[model samples]
Target chain A: MNESGHNGLVERVAHELKRSIKIDPSFDESVMAEVRRHGKPAMWVRVIAWWRRPQQLSLSPLSMAASAAVLILAVAVSPVRFGNPDGVEPIAEDPAARVIRFELDAPRASSVTLSGDFNDWDLEATPMTRTSSGEWVTTVKLVPGRYEYTFVVDGDKWVPDPAAPPSLFDDFGGTSSTITVPEV
Target chain B: MVESDGQLVRSVLAGDVDRYAILVERYRDRLGRYAYRMLGNLEDSEEVLQDTFVRAFKSLKNCQDPELFGRWVFKILVNRARTAGSIRGRRDRLFVTDEIAILNASDMKQSEYGWREEIERALSELPADQREAFILKYVEELRYDEMAEVTGVGVSALKMRVNRACRRLRELLEGVYRE
Candidate 1:
């Protein structure tokens, strides 16, 4: 057969097949029910639900306010300095800051470095120290916030923190680990 | 306004679990037809469809682009249908008599059009890969690129499969067309 005739035949077959097939109405309902049975709320929804949920407090508002007032009065009455009373020097210590220790096991690796949102993914910014037990470890002070990071092994392979939450695939086709440092 | 697939996907991911029904409803018919054609049976097709939707829901977050949700879900359905078809094929081989009885019953229901029966029989006789390629290209009217994405096969190979399928189908249905 000529190409056009062949094309016409194919189109006719497709149309006939298409016209003959009809999905049962209940198919969608059945599928939806099965999905509902197995489907959980998306991650974001669960997080929002957690946020909107009412939290119980041990102290009533009136009592809590009264306690706060009393504490303020006591603090005012006392001569204790919350910080440098001279006001000449800035406070060097942040009570909300926390020291987070990052550890990775890389016995076969010659070197390991930590890189993440904290260090702007600068691979060389935080080099890890190898312990005698062959574990690479590093400590860094971080303020409370969410961060995505990865480890650079031997200044080449970028590996996500296996212990952290699921890593996000970056735009550069690389994986990065995520962490949320809670505010104290 | 009807929300795009991408919008619906975002809504579903934002915690509106019910919005997923919109997606299910949207693609059900098209995917059902594809699965039916691929599996050559309604029961296996529906099973694959249900499984595909559930799997898609669980992996929605990992869908790189929600805009192409149809293609992504179709890919999953295609894979599930292939697996289901394989299992069914094995069972049919073991229970050849039962398989023939079931097919004959099905053919009776579809016997209204002898041409339809001939086409369906010819389609089922094609190799699975060629049948898939032919259905996706000619029946589903998918572009070559879309077929490649869904089948994970290169465009040239898909074209060759479709060509081979057409040749074989013409040969099978020659008597019907001649009459």
Candidate 2:
């Protein structure tokens, strides 16, 4: 075909391709159903929910005084823990749970948290510590299983790990990186 | 007066969940067409389209420009279609487009139907990347810059893909047209 004829064919094909298929309103309803199910409370709402959640404390006046006296006596005897001034204690490792280290390089992020199937996708559950070089790192003890996760950068940005394989799209329409722990 | 995409997005984010239906309605058909063309079947396209909207609604707060919601949702649909296509993993499975052509046949003239089927078959034969670039450029009417944003591909590569796609499509369908 000549140049103009070829152009005509291409344009005609493009026009036909652009003719959109008829979509039912039910598609919108199904999407909204999913959105409603995945609807998250705003940060303020979550904060309020946390604040208003019922927490219980039990103490008698006599017991409180006794506890304070004991604390004061212990402090006087040792201004700080003799071997550890910071009073940090080592955590015991579980033989059944495997240690997996998760890291993300987010130098500009004020904070980063790891959320996944392992943590019930809770934003605050697995706060990562910032290293001197600006990488955020955290270790979790997980039993053998496949888990999907993402890094929450600067509190709200959901980012999948660039170094890991991505998981299939979840029911909520998000894709997180997947890690499979082998049975050792 | 019809509300701007920004207004509807803001309302949806502000707890007026019903307003999201409007956004879904506004973009579903356009996005559906892209998905169908990309995936070459109705089932995968509808699934991807639904997921795109749900994902957009779920992540509405992350949308940097609410006024450009359509573009943002189109990006999601593109990503979803890519993933769906990869998972399906074979072109033979895409013969469902033949079923779609038959369903659409009643609405089109006989010659027009045959030409469209030839085009769709030719489109489905191109490499996924070329088909995607061509569809975004011509069918979706997206500019190269916008296509770059959606596909995360550089403009030069996209232009090459579009050029190759047009050439290959013409080569595939020229015989049918001449006859």
* Per-candidate DockQ vs. reference: 0.16, 0.21
lDDT of 1 at A151: 77
Candidate 2 off by > 4 Å: A43-184, B91-94, B98-100
Residue A28 C-alpha lDDT in model 2: 80
List all candidate RMSDs to the true structure.
14.4, 12.5
lDDT of 2 by residue, A93-158 (tens): 446789999999989999998977565455667899999999999999998988878887765566
List per-model TM-scores for chain B. 0.87, 0.93
Best by TM-score: 2
- Residues B59-139, model 1: lDDT tens digits: 776566788899878887876676576667656623122222244555555444566666778878787778889999887
Scored on chain A only, each candidate's TM-score is 0.48, 0.48
Off by over 4 Å in 1: A1-4, A42-184, B93-112
Tens digits of per-residue lDDT for model 2, B23-136: 988887888899889877788788988877876776676576778988878877776776677666543545345446688788879988888788888888887778889999
Instruction: Report, for every candidate in turn, its global Cα lDDT versus the true structure.
Output: 0.74, 0.77
Best by DockQ: 2
In lDDT terms, which candidate is top? 2
